[model samples]
Target: MIINKILNVDDYYYDVFMAISGTLTGFSANELQSTGLAETYYKHILGQIETATFLEFLNVSKSILENSFSQDQLRNAIQSEIMADPGMQDMSNNIITMWYLGTWEGTYVNELSYKESLVWNVMHAHPPGAKQPGFKSWAVQPVNSNS
Candidate 1:
């Protein structure tokens, strides 16, 4: 089905994208938006997938958002509706990888993507060369963040 026939891409596509992304990544929409790569990643994913497939993914995302009530329900819906679909597997993997590693298809999307990669946050560290702590800061033992 042609996407534009039923849904307006220019209006709510990104919102749906963010919602689905947040569910898939276990991050809040606010945290994902804080990276400043929402638009960048949205456009990038759109470019990477066939329009028909991408639209279906968006529709499923919207459905998942509207129907899911709790965390388990959301995750189950994603696993069944999104991950189980053969057509969506590559794109689903890409979204997760993109959010965590800041790469699409194993390549960095951009410098900003690298700088703001979620992996660094998960590790409680900064991306190397993206942010400088200070001269000789690394020489000092890093504090145990988990303590």
Candidate 2:
């Protein structure tokens, strides 16, 4: 239920999370809940918006979702809003980073497996310590994933 509240979806919190995350962080939330990462993310978000209330963030998320803004629009608006509300912006980016990195920056109670991380897709590279293609792989070339 809290997941739905976060994404402002009526049902299928995973799908809603997938959409919001894909839109917000450019990562998929598929299987994230099964790994318990979704719950951890929800807690992190709830903590970030605890100042006024979870409902405050929910109201904002609901408003944003109702508009069906494009990902760029959502990102730009959030980027601008960070000036006015830095904490929420940091929290939002942290959420995105969680989707991206599969880990939070600071200490947290929940455990995460870096092996399950998603940033590899964004970066178009191999995970650290996972493998080495060969000597000088980095020197030769790497695809420009962002482009």
Candidate 3:
């Protein structure tokens, strides 16, 4: 007889969230953790959505991450499994927006998240007025300014 394994989302909900966020945002888990806002984002998401629905989303995300082997496969799995569901779409979009823009539901999550937002890095700039680059550092060119 074969025993089916149960998906224990509560055992690894945050891990699943990070993996899903990385996949959704095209960033790695390490990058997301480096922001120091993973816990904040996780709690925010939990507070925004219902417990049962959040657990279900975590379970689906866990399955997709497990079954996907390559980036292409991951994208396909996400498109079919997560993006296909209206509820999951909202959660996924929020996760992507939070990672890239440091906001959720069109509002800034916090000052920390805004400071460490990924969109600035993607655009090869820092968040305006967040990180001062020293006195007159703009005289020369930025170190990573070259495309």
Give lDDT per model, in order. Answer: 0.81, 0.54, 0.80
What TM-score, over all chains together, does every model reach?
0.83, 0.55, 0.84
Model 3 per-residue lDDT tens digits across residues 34-111: 898988898898898798898898888888777777778878988898889998898888889999999989888988
- List candidate 2 segments past 4 Å from native: 1-19, 28-36, 43-54, 69-76, 80-84, 108-111, 130-147
| Candidate number with greatest TM-score | 3
lDDT of 3 at 15: 77
lDDT of 1 by residue, 26-134 (tens): 8877899899898899898888778788888888888887888877888888889888988787778889999999999989998899988888888877887778767
Can you write out model 2's per-residue Cα lDDT over 7-39, one digit (the tens) per residue? 444444334444455556644455454444666
Between candidates 1 and 3, name the one with more favorable lDDT: 1
Superposed model 3: Cα runs more than 4 Å off: 1-11, 142-147
Better of 1 and 3 by TM-score: 3
Top model number, lDDT: 1
Ranking by TM-score: 3, 1, 2
